[model samples]
Target: MTSSTPLRIGVMGAHSTGKSLLMRRIEMELHGQGIPVARTGNLGRRAALVPLPKMQHHTLASTTWVIATGIADEIAAWARLEKGPVQVVLADRACWDALAYFRAALEWRQQTAPRAEREALHQLAHAHGRTYDLLLATVLDPDVPVESKHDYDPRYRTLVDRHTHDFLREENIRHVRVTSDPASQELAIEHALQLCMTEAPA
Candidate 1:
């Protein structure tokens, strides 16, 4: 937060796991304190418009596009400070999110991505991930039904959640995990606020 670049807070998880809701809560809290934030999101919807495969059918190309585009979006969000100061950049999906979805897709299809290609993507995601000041990853709760509006494949969704955490652990990336519980959500909000407010505008 002390850096001229805005503090980047990213949230990542499965499609229906409340990633957006958690980010929205943080955004509201920052705004209440008069902290400016820029959010980058809707990557999945945007990818589909690009006619790239997603979800259960996510491919290496699509995954690459998603991650690279997310990086660009984050850079753009940071660049917004030139026009006006933005204290934080709230990224709806962190760079590794697409890789997780792709990993899940491979598992769902019983296919394996080439070792080199997979490793390269991981390197790219890992590099971008280091820039985040705070990252929140949501845990999927299968007991809670997804809203009918989203026609997600339960099996695919579960795999995505599993792989998301798997990648986090494997990479040893530091992040706070948010669950469905209200208490967990509140703690995450507090943690994020503390990170931003420490160097935020008074």
Candidate 2:
């Protein structure tokens, strides 16, 4: 890829599934290969769109959702601007899944709202899916416990995971499933790198 058109690679999985760690590792590996890389987390802690009231109340979930969505929008804008081949862009979150999860959350909150809100959330979810270049599914071993203190409902977690996989399959996006093993993590990074390299312009 040229300096202007970076290959975007996304790493997605459940919270505390080593998504951040894997992203760091990928950066290191790409650097070793002399590849220029730009990396960002799926969700940022301090996104600007977070309402001041929500920040004052320490609304972790809302803040996270806003950050994640912001990153997606930002990346999509960047891709549109850089029309030539460029370095690699590795994102630690999957934008499409985040949109879906947020849509689910919004619908739950507006359970009593008019039908228009429901339709809007659905439209938003569909729009978000078209933003990403690829979706990486970071699979946690079923034995691993969900340890994040975040209040994501257990049922919601299950639903998002299933939906994420289904979305990737439907989009025909290249995905690498990283197991809990150390070797598997390395392999996953390698697989992602290969995908990035292949997509790069000759």
Candidate 3:
């Protein structure tokens, strides 16, 4: 990347779209290319050792807490990478993903968060989202289904998928959509690399 600062990226998609696998593969490929890469894990895995506010309860407040933790984790990793010569900070998910899930879940439950609160959350997420240099999106493939304990039902996945797609389109966020195939995956990595290389680190 042209930017001296590490490229901050968000790897996002609907639930069980293999984002973690993509994140790990991308990290490996980047490291192989000698591009220093650090990754932030899902809500709990990467920061498991570090105590977080109770996020298991997925209320609006809890989801907002999750978004804060995600941003905080990314920033902390970015700060460390700056000291070393790391060129990219790859995050498992971004704040926008959280917002999508938050809204999707609320809708699924037929519950509505107040407009002011929801708008505030969106604004907050959008502000933090600017920190991203590139966003890699995983497009869901019905042909290749990954097993999931929580998202076993295709209907829920479809719902989240719809919301994710709708929000991404609405925001017109700059992103690369990776299909669920090896060839597409590699191509996405190529595109992701190209995108990362274009970011100017602040």
Give the whole-model CA lDDT for all candidates, comma-separated: 0.90, 0.58, 0.73
The TM-score of predicted model 2 comes to 0.64
lDDT of 1 by residue, 1-202 (tens): 2357788999999888899989888999999988888889999999999999989999989999999999999888867645577778999999988888999999999999889999999899988988788889999988988779988899999999999999999889899999999999999999999989996543
Q: After superposition, how far is residue 20 of candidate 2 from its true place, in Å?
A: 1.6
**Candidate 2 C-alpha lDDT tens digits along 104-162:** 34443443334765455445544654545555677645577765686545555554555
Error of 3 at 111 (Å): 1.8
Model 1 error, position 44 (Å) = 0.5
| Superior by TM-score: candidate 2 or candidate 3 | 3
Off by over 4 Å in 3: 1-4, 44-57, 81-83, 148-151, 197-202
The C-alpha local distance difference test score for the whole of candidate 2 amounts to 0.58
Error of 3 at 20 (Å): 0.9
Per-candidate TM vs. native? Answer: 0.95, 0.64, 0.84
Worst 10 residues of 1 by lDDT: 78-87
* Best candidate according to lDDT: 1
lDDT of 3 by residue, 82-143 (tens): 44656788888878887777766777667888899888888878888976877878887878
The CA-based lDDT of model 1 is what?
0.90
Is 2 or 3 the stronger prediction by lDDT? 3
